[model samples]
Structure formats: structure tokens, C-alpha cells
Target: MTNNSTCNPLLLGNQLCFPLYASARKIVAAYNPFLKEIGLTYPQYVTMMVLWEEKKITMHDLGKRLYLDSGTLTPVLKKLENMGYVTRSRKPEDERVVIVEITPEGQALREKAEKVPYAMGCLINRKGNLFTPEEVETLKKQLYRLIHALE
Candidate 1:
């Protein structure tokens, strides 16, 4: 009945998920100062990113794109709406469908956010970098593959 490290499935070090979770937290923390200056939390920033690109999209599609459920996404949308950055309204033809669109203010914020990726890139890929730009791209592709597979 002796415990063996190789056979210990419950060990934290044996879980692939731990590093992924921790790395996501660290990356989000790194984005905090820039996001703070923009007056958005990370979730809001990501939501706005999609809205900026799509200009308008349904709530269902936004949730699928962001990997968020309505329970989690609703509040984020509400806050963005309250900030006058976005507007959410029911579709006239389909009451059950809610559409989200970026407002003029939200579009203006995109100018401020334009610098965030560059700043984060410098932080992550400065001298003695943890990952090269190529490595980052490769990793991102791999992660997306994994996400698609999971879905």
C-alpha cells in the first residue's frame, strides 16, 4: 500500500491544469495596471474587445466568443452599459434575444486600449524574456486548439 509519486494522480504537480490556471492569473494581473487606466476590469476589457471588432453582436454569440455563461456575462454587460460604453437591448423581432453594441464612448476607449497590447508585449517579451514572440504565437495556437477540442 506504499504511495508512489508516479502513481499519485491526486498530486498537484501531476495536474496539467494547475500551471494553466496560475499562468492565466499572472497574465491577468500583468494586464491590471493598463486596464485600470482604461477604467475596465479584465472581463470588461475582453468584452469590449469583441464589441469593438463586431460593433454589434447577439448576447448568445458574445457569450460563445468569450466562453462566458449568461450568469457571468450579464453583470459585465450591465456595468459596461452603466458606464455608457455599451448598450444592450432586446431584439424587436425576438424578445428573447439581446443584442450588444458599443457606444461612441466605447469606440473612443479603443484609442486608449490600442496601447495595452504593446505595453503587455514589452512586459512579457522584454530583455531576458520568458517567451519569444514566435513562441507566444505558437502557444496561443496550441491553446486554441486545446480549447476547440474541449468544446
Candidate 2:
């Protein structure tokens, strides 16, 4: 008689998505305090990033920039409107189209946020991480390029 045992344990290093997902969670959590001070959630912060780049855009354009659909952008935009950070209104010439414009408050908030990416960079660098600001921006460009290419 013989007995055999196997340990198919999934260790941290063995799981690819685990680290990526974990890192994202921790990074978002780290931004919580800062974002709270600025009246934003993770998604809203990303939304602000897009609006900061484009002064005014159609809802469709906003969705494209955020890689989200109306279902997602609609609610977030609504929240921003409630916060007086943005204005969502029907286009004057096209009743079917909604235009989103950043408000003065939103613009000011974005100015305040200019340092957020840098601060986040510092946090990531503290643990001997390989990502610096340049690497991070490059990576962002590459990922957005990939996203656009896929779409």
C-alpha cells in the first residue's frame, strides 16, 4: 500500500492577479484620506482627472475617456453635479446629447489635486518600488494606448 499527498496551495507570489488587485486596493485606500479632504471617491477622482484634461465634453466623450459607459458615468456625474463640481445639461442644439462642463469649483479642486499624483508616487516609492513618476506616467500612456488600440 502506498499513500501520496499533494499541496496545491496558492501562495501570494504564485497568484498574478492577487498582487495586482491587492496593490490597487492598497493604493486606493491610501488615497482615501487625501481624496476625502478634497471631496472625491476613487472613481470621482479619476473622473475629475478626465474633466481636468477636457474643459467641456459630451457625455459620450466623458464615457470614452473614463472607459466607462453611461450607466457608470451618469451616476458619478450626477454626484459631481450635486457637489457643484460639474454641470450636466442637454446640448442646446441637440436635445439628445448631454454636455458635461467643469465648474469653477471643479477647476479649483483639480488645481489642488495637482500634487496628488506626486504624493501617491512618493508612497509607492517608499517600499523600494520600481515605479517613479516618469515610469508611472509612461505606464499610464502605454495602458491608455493599449485601451484605445483595443477599442
Candidate 3:
């Protein structure tokens, strides 16, 4: 009989999740400076990205799209509403469902946000950049696969 405790797969460095978690934190942190300039955080930025694309979405739908729950999303939506960037209301037909719509002010902010992707791309391609553009795309695809598998 072989005792395999010494060969444990549970070791910190041997687990896949550690690197994924660390990398996710690093990538989000990378957005801080630019997001700070625009008065947004990484979560807020991504929420706006989806809202920008969808125009208006039910809170349930937004939560699904963002892989977030209402508990996590409600405050972000509320903050955006307070910032005059969005409006949230209960749907008349179904009061249980809430609708979120970007404001005209939010529409105007899109022009300002247009440069954000380019700026982020530049950061991703900087001298010490961890991955090439192609590699980054590949990693994104792989991560999406992992996400789907987990789901």
C-alpha cells in the first residue's frame, strides 16, 4: 500500500483555482487607475458595459448576464442611479420584476468610455504585459469554456 499524503493534489500551488483567483484580482486591480479617473470601480465598469450594450434590461436579466445575484447587483444599480447614469423602476406589468435603463447622461458618458477599451488594451500590451494579444484572446476563450463547464 502506498501512502500518498505527501503527494497531495490539495497543495496550494497544485490547485488551479489559486492562479485563476490571483490573476482575476490582478486584472481587476489593473483597471483601478483608469476607473478611478472616471469615478467607477471594476464591477461598476462591467455593469455599465452590459447596460451600454443592452440599453435596457430587467434586473433579473442583468444579474444573469453579469453572473451576479440581486444582492450584489442592487447596490451597484442604486449607485448608478444616484450618479444620474441610470434609472431603475418596478415593471408595471409585473411589479416583482425591476427594469433598469441607462439615462441620457449615461448615453453621453459612452463617448467618454469609448477610449477605455483602447487604454486597457494598451495596458495589456505594455512592456511587462503578461500575455500577447493572441494569448489573451485564447485565455479568454479557455476561461469561458471553464465557466460553462463549471455551470
Candidate 4:
């Protein structure tokens, strides 16, 4: 029987998972400077993504769209509200349901946020930016497939 344990020491760089995870983290960290300038974190940016697509949506719907739960979103929404970017309230039609709506301030912030993609584009340009567009597309597709498959 092959003694797999006798294989070469687990060189982190040689392991796809380690390097891949570190690379992802490093890239996300690279975005920190820019994101900080805009007062948003990675998770916050994702939340803005769905909110940008839908002017107003229920917390439940937002959670579903963002793959987040109330525990994660509640504070994020509160922060946005405190920043005057969004408004959260119980739905008049369904008091049981909470709704979130972006304000003019939020829309204006969206306009400001329009530059983030450009900023991120420049950072991803390392290695001639080989991993930027291509990998993003492929990874999104693969992750989507995995998410659906696992579901």
C-alpha cells in the first residue's frame, strides 16, 4: 500500500487549497485600502451589490440574495442606516417582515461606488491581470454550480 503520509512535506505553495486561499485573502486585502476609502468592507460591498440591483427588498429576500443571514445582515443594515445610506423599517403591509430601502444618499454612494470596479481592476492587473476577469468569471460559474449542486 502506498504510504501517502510519506509524501513530501505539505509545502503550502504546492497545495492548491492553501495558495488559492491565501491568494484570495491577499487579493481581498489588496482591496482594503480602496474599500476603506469608500467606507465599506468586502461583505458590505456584496450587500450593496444586491441592494443596487433592487431599490428595496425584504430582509429575507436580501439575505437569500446575499447568502447571508439575519445575524450577519442586521448589523450591516444598521451601519448603513447610521451612515445615512439606507433605511430599514418594518413593512407596513406585513409588519412581520422588515424592509430595507436605499436612500438618495445611498444612491449617491452607489455613484461613488461605481469607481470601485475600476479601482479593483487596476489591482487585479498584476501578472498582466491574468486572473482578474477570466478567473472571476470561471470562479463565479464554478461556485454557482457548486452552490446549486450542494443545495
For lDDT, the strongest prediction is: 1
Scanning candidate 2 in windows of ten residues, the lowest lDDT window is: 1-10
Query: lDDT for each of the candidates?
Result: 0.95, 0.85, 0.88, 0.83
lDDT of 1 by residue, 1-151 (tens): 3458767888888888899999999999999999999999999999999999999999999999999999999999999999999999999999999999999999999999999999998898777688877988999999999899999
Clashing residue pairs in candidate 4, if any? 125-129
Looking at candidate 1, what is the lDDT of residue 83? Answer: 100
TM-score per candidate, chains pooled:
0.92, 0.78, 0.89, 0.81
Q: Rank order by TM-score, top first?
A: 1, 3, 4, 2
On residues 28-133, what C-alpha lDDT tens digit does candidate 2 reach at each position? 9999887887779989999988888898999998888778999988999999999999999998898999999999999999878887887877776787887666
- Candidate 4 global CA lDDT score: 0.83
Q: What C-alpha lDDT, on a 0 to 100 scale, does residue 22 get in candidate 2?
A: 91
Residue lDDT tens for model 3, 11-128: 7766889999998999898888888888888888888998899999999999988889999999999999999999999999999999999999988888877788888778987867
Q: Relative to the unseen true structure, what is the C-alpha lDDT of residue 141 in candidate 2, on a scale of 0 to 100?
A: 96
Q: lDDT of model 1 at residue 54?
A: 99
Model 4 over residues 116-145: C-alpha lDDT tens digits?
A: 889878777845855756878998898678
Top TM-score model? 1
Instruction: Rate residue 77 of model 2 by lDDT.
Output: 92
Task: Write the number of the candidate with greater TM-score, choosing between 1 and 4.
Answer: 1
* Clash counts for the predictions, in order: 0, 0, 0, 1
Off by over 4 Å in 4: 1-20, 132-135
